[model samples]
Target: MGNQPETHPNPTIDPKSGFNSETRTFQSLRPKTPLPPLSQPLSVTDYTLSLIPSTSLSATAMIDSDTDTHLSYSVFIRQIKSLSSSLKSLFPSLSKGHVALIISPSSLHVPVLYFSLLSLGVVVAPANPLSTHSELTHHVQLTKPVIAFATSSTSTHIPNLKFGTVLIDSPQFISMLNNFNNSEPPRVEVAQSDVAAILFSSGTTGRVKGVELTHRNFIALTGGFYYTNLMLGNLDEKESNKVSLFTPPLFHVFGFFMMVWTIAFGETLVLMKRFDFEGMLKLVEKYRIDSIPVSPPLVVLLAKSELVNKYDVSSLKIVGCGGAPLGKEVGESFAARFPNVIIEQVT
Candidate 1:
């Protein structure tokens, strides 16, 4: 007889856990997200810019909750382009592969600067604005940044660098944002593998370490959130009007990545310079905020704080908790309180 066809039974998978018994692993149930070609020369800035809807250009991109200032998407993109040109002209020494340290509180300007720097292929190394002199020095040493960006209050902590420091709150920096006469800055060819940002660890175990993230790393991260939301039917027409309040520090991974995702999805982001329980509640009511990315502590506060009752937070639809594990009790308490709201825990 000819060779008999091999016979095998299909592997059993747990529907609830998505576990493959034969493979001894948990399989992903979500559809795979498509990323750009690895060989393509694309920066995270370009990738994110491409995803923004042209129709939303005139929409509000960000709002400073502290100052009640609003920045439109049209103005935001213009500033990025203008600032990119100004930076190149003012500091001819700055170029691709150079690192720039950014130490400032969250504001409208920080996001614009981030996109501009990434487009130039400059590695953004943002540290806490409240970092001690010694800590700042350690970071400077690690990244060897050519220039530093700081606010007047935090610039003193920055050490001397190759190009000195530019205060983000200074008039000169503001002028840079308005330099419309300058032609568009020459684009740099950035590889997916090129180091884009040097983020630091939380320093829980030991000294804080700089973590290098590449352009592709951020592209994939943003793409995952974008495509997943699309697949889950979460990007409906109403989703475009969703407003998000970010209470986390911009330097942290949670806030940093979410900022990127928020821009790519063209959502209005409200930034709080500092976190205050009552202040956060008030902003939610004022802005009609429907989404917030938070930590466990904030989750607990939302679940237990009576201050939440004082404000009209009925608009809140999603609360994303990260940075640590959310206790079952805490999760249940939050769910019980806001039965209609979704509490998404991100590792």
Candidate 2:
């Protein structure tokens, strides 16, 4: 007689809930109740401050991958308060209605400046330092920033104004960081609906348009991420500290959100002053970068470049690619080359 195949029992079904093996679709595992959102208006800075851990290893300490410089959370927050207080004293007219233009590459001071300005109810408009004077002039007109913040090199790009540009790297700015007399800045009421940032769009199709993002918008965005990571069981995992590398400009939406996301998740961020493909591989080896936020073009490089084989990128476990469409074949090739790494394509 021919060998008989082993017989298996039918899968169990919960008749009361109308769920069975034959069911093609079902209700969400989560309850149908609406998720609670922040009741009161909250600023993005305030929201991030609430998420900061009472004590953490690297969460508070942001390391600059290039310069090997670090800014601990305590010092970062203190500087924010001091800078806010000093800015208020120097330019009392700089209030909720005013905007400050920041033109510089990613640096330790950027976050300090951003948090301080936002907490004081001042709108932050960060623009690409590489933008032409004509392009910047248009942005300046659109944002109408009361004051400007730039590096020594980029400060020349900013045109003459009522309140001129403050060089972030100068000794003067350094003194602002040490102004601890006003330990805590005067509380400024920043509503959730108030404009938090005026981010410019990538001018690929036409002249860039400024998009206004509000505090409420960021609150909900951060909340959604928190809920997602919680459900995925990542937030509670007892794993080695994760380090992430950002090759994109922080001024762009993708880079901007990732920076804030890293802060929320307590991950150490490794910033590249500018994106260079070869330099990125070296950073991964040096910093032991565990994950990277990449665009489609970068994914293509990973799939085809022999240079990846030269680097010891064994520590990398995640590659998040977005900003454009990626092909199925490219994904398959990347997966075949590095089976240990998970490639998440964000559309």
Candidate 3:
């Protein structure tokens, strides 16, 4: 009776997840850009085109570290149009719903090819250049690509394609990019729901499955992220010359989305044809890369590697780690090492 004198009130438990919950769906206080109607004829390329300022002649769109090539926004757009024209001329039957299987390393022409294909309502199916013959065959059969865009090194892996292969590194393809034509390619109306790209999964859990990301999906996804950044005052430094080094494979979602995001936000991208730990450090020093989008493993490397100490990485202001969860200890170690750099871990 004496022990029962001090009884406490029982806490209510949540029905789901077996714990008391404070999580609630809340509306954002910040206003966002009105999304276009579902019926709107919009392509991601066109959306990206709209982001380019008409007077932005001097803004560098991308830099090719392999060739030391630089393309400004105006030049980049012009190249897209020219390449679209060339693609149309070469494969007259290439139409909406046609797939272009791309197997090439990161290069100056990758972005141009992607934008050009999407502009014409073509579905881009980019794959890893290092994929084996059987893996390549599986991808080819899955996508049923009408045309293939590959390099000389990777083109041998492509089976007999319907429209043949275009070697991205070949002089013929380079010629197409340089040639200016008066006749514009006929405009193809692409709906917002239309499939833009068939990005593949890591195949870690199972066989690789092609993920069909649509125009509206990209629009909504990117728009929300960008708007949130705008709300956070991240866009206030719009005039500052921002540069980012991308270490992930462009075929993967993280790298693919980063490429699109970098372009949309007008940041100069420094692409490495291949990732090498020491090479990455050198590139960071050379380009004065202000930020980098890295995976979790790279985060641990950054935390533990003595290689980072040898490079002049003072310009690096942000280290964005994503695609996997980073441990608290690893993050803490990274923070301790690079106090000046902001380490943002995104799920």
Candidate 4:
């Protein structure tokens, strides 16, 4: 033989359960996913933007399920660039390492602003738009954001900050998105370890605290989802045609990360400004939503609600449930009702 390859013994596994007794844990059988070098300078926005297929640029990127408004990938990218440039010009003091608070409901503008802020290396701190003045103040104290973005209705709740507040609903904000300067935002070298966002806890158990998430954290998360889908043979030539509806609030960690994940794969995301059980079903039927991220409560509702039969939900392929413990009975009922749809529980 010209050369012989070295071989190693297979890992020991229990014959009955396939458990690794030596390590006292079961090893994942999935193939390892390749990640970029840790020392490399990268932002979650850049990583996600790189994953978008060139062909998907013309496809729908987001839809306002309430108003039926549509946003294309091409326009969304352009808006991100434009908004980034405009923010730099408007608030020269806003720079990398600075935090910006975002208090807004689910809207097409939120994602564009999020990507823009991240590209510029600004730390995004998004809070519940429905928060009271005292709650907003607590958030402001925690993050110490220099600038804030809010809507006309929610702006009153936010305390003044260094850069004041930019109302997303104003005509002025729209003009920023339509920046005609043609000059791109100056390139920002964001380290993967830099803080990306500060999201708040639910405050159910105690006082809500700000949770810091780094750029590398999100890059890894989005990457894992991207590769897992590929491994499952979910990403095909028609991947852009897949639609996902988000029932969670954008300010929550579940919704925020999933939003980024959906965009990274160039899938159309449907957002509802306000969650209505019947409205969610209507959107599912209208857009042919393939998947949805749901909480335990939503899962129970889906399993037992009579309204589910009122619409055509045959297109739903997956229901990702997380954020809390799902009762075994609830999971069984949901599985039995939606036999074709897979219930993916995340612990």
In order, candidate lDDTs are 0.90, 0.80, 0.83, 0.90
Name the regions of candidate 3 deviating beyond 4 angstroms.
Answer: 1-33, 53-56
- Model 4 / residue 261 / CA error / Å: 0.4
Q: Candidate 4: where are CA atoms >4 Å away? A: 1-29
Error of 4 at 2 (Å): 26
Give the clashing residue pairs of candidate 4, or none.
none
Error of 1 at 214 (Å): 0.7
Q: Global lDDT for candidate 3?
A: 0.83
lDDT of 3 by residue, 171-220 (tens): 99987887776367679999999999999988899888899999888777
Q: Please, what are the lDDT tens digits per residue for candidate 4 over residues 1-347?
A: 11222222455765444467777886554455667887999999999999987778899999998789999999999999999999988998788989999999999999999999999999999999999989998998899999999999999978778999999999999999978575988899999999999999999989889999999999988888888777677778665478999999888999999999999889899999999899999999999999999999999999999999999999999999978888999999999999999989864
Candidate whose lDDT is highest:
1
Worst 10 residues of 1 by lDDT: 1-10
Ranked by lDDT, top first:
1, 4, 3, 2
User: Which candidate should be chosen as best, given TM-score against the real structure?
Assistant: 1
Clashing pairs in 2: none
Q: Which pairs clash in the backbone of model 3?
A: none
1 or 3, which is superior by TM-score?
1
lDDT of 1 by residue, 257-337 (tens): 999999998889999999899999999999999999999999999999988889999999999999999999999999999
